[model samples]
Target: MRVLVTGGAGFIGSAVVRHLVNDKRFDVLSIDKLTYAGTLTSMVSVNDNPLYRFENADVCDKTAITQAMSDFRPDRIMHLAAESHVDRSITGAKDFVETNVLGTFNMLECARAYWQSLDSRAKETFRFLHISTDEVYGSLGKEGLFTESTPYDPSSPYSATKAASDHLAKAWERTYGLPVVISNCSNNYGPFHFPEKLIPLMIINAMEGKSLPVYGSGSNIRDWLFVEDHAKALDLIAERGRVGETYNVGGRNEQRNIDVVNRICTLMDEFRPEHGPHSRLIKCVEDRPGHDARYAIDATKLEQELCWKAVENFDTGIEKTVKWYLENEWWWSPLRQRYKGERLGLLPSGA
Candidate 1:
């Protein structure tokens, strides 16, 4: 099958493109805007593959998106493009709105038109998969998991924009009869992750003996999913999932922010003894405005319906992640030079 994967250069998107091209034997047309976080290096494994093609284009550009869709004539459209960083979203929301909301609208409209132009058999086989996040469900208390039925309570600009896109996907399916499936996933961490995120930032910072900033006592809890596992799940859902249904994908591994950082420190100490007591660099910093206290996903629906389960628990996943960063400095070193792992998401008024 031929697949058009938007944001195919970003962390999770690149994972999907690699999986489809290398494992599934699917022809993949990767369309990305090459934002700061979107690096082509993530797709290095499949860059030269016969089935892989790359296009540097924004999803919001209807002309480019439509032209690519027309040319590729894909069986599936996996939409993963967006401004994803929560801290960055807090500081500048316009980009999030434009890309996540408006970009999604453009993709949906273009895909609908393309689908309508398809013949009966092709239209029946075509699918559009909208990838999303669990943050749209808002903060959880000390307990409970975010199910597909959970009402949206987006607190940050990032989540709000994703929530809007989610609605647009569902609306298109309902009103336009588009073959659409949406999946809301938990926090993804693994190799090729940009350094600005919590896990990568802490890993690089600890290695360099720099201060590790933990926000607001570091109690915020997040369910972590391995990017490769998520890519597999996306392929599965896109192939067999029921149209108009939403699936919640998660690692089923929840850890507090501080605990996650400490785990990284312990792993570093065990593997690279030179980084002694990495936890010593732990420093509590001010929390971002509207920071969600906790987020956990109940992926029972995805598992039971699609037979999908995350293979990596927190311990195994984090160990592999730390090892990847240590061994693959060439991949991340340039990124560090560009983005020095500074703090973001500070409110303008200092609320």
Candidate 2:
């Protein structure tokens, strides 16, 4: 299979590309603009492989995207390119809309055009998978999980753009008869994660003896999904999933933000005893604007229909993530230099 993955250099995108090339041995083309959070080095594991290639391109540029689609002639397109950080979006909503909303619109048009040119069998077999976040469902109370049928009530600029893109994807399928499948996933943590995210930031900060910032007393909750498992779910959803359906993929692991930081501290204490009790570095800070109280996904549809199961829970997945950062400084050192641990998402009064 020839699969074209946009944003293939970013955290979750890179995971999908690596699985496609190294495990499935599919001919994969990764198109990325090398944005601040994306680095080609994330795909080093499969870059030299015969089945893998990359193009430096932007999905927001419809002409470039259409040209690449024409050239690659991919059987499957996994649209993952987006400005995905909620905190970043609070300060910079325009970029999120341009990248997530406009980019997805352009990608859908490009995919539809390409699908039209394909022969009957090729068109029937083609798939466009739109990967999104569970944040689109907004905050959950302490009771229920976010099922596939939950109405979207996005609370942040980042998730609002993603919600718009999700709607566009389904509209393309319904209006233009394009074959599209969507997967909204929970928080992902594993290797090659960007340092700005909660998990990696804590790991790297604890390593360097910097303060591990926990926002809003750390009571906010998130369901964690191992990135590799989410990648596998994407593959299955694209391969055999019914078109015009949305699947929720989650690791079934929920943790309070403070507990997550404390767990990381405990892990650091085990791995780097010389650091001597990392929990002392925990520092609670101002909460983000419109921070969701909780997010938990009910992936029963994906689990029952697609038989997808996450292999890593919070305890195991977090241990693996911490170890990866501990062992792979070569991969993260340059990123740390560029990001300097400055806090993000500071909003002024009277919006």
**Model 1 TM-score?**
0.97
Residue lDDT tens for model 1, 189-295? 99998877888888888888888888888888888899999999999999999999999999988888889989999998898787687888898887778989999
User: What stretches of model 1 exceed 4 Å from their correct place?
Assistant: 341-351
Clashes of 1: 0
Instruction: Report the number of clashing residue pairs per model.
Output: 0, 0
Estimate candidate 2's RMSD in Å: 2.6
Off by over 4 Å in 2: 341-351
Query: What TM-score against the true fold does each predicted structure earn?
Result: 0.97, 0.97
What is the Cα-based TM-score of model 2?
A: 0.97
Cα RMSD for candidates in order: 2.5, 2.6
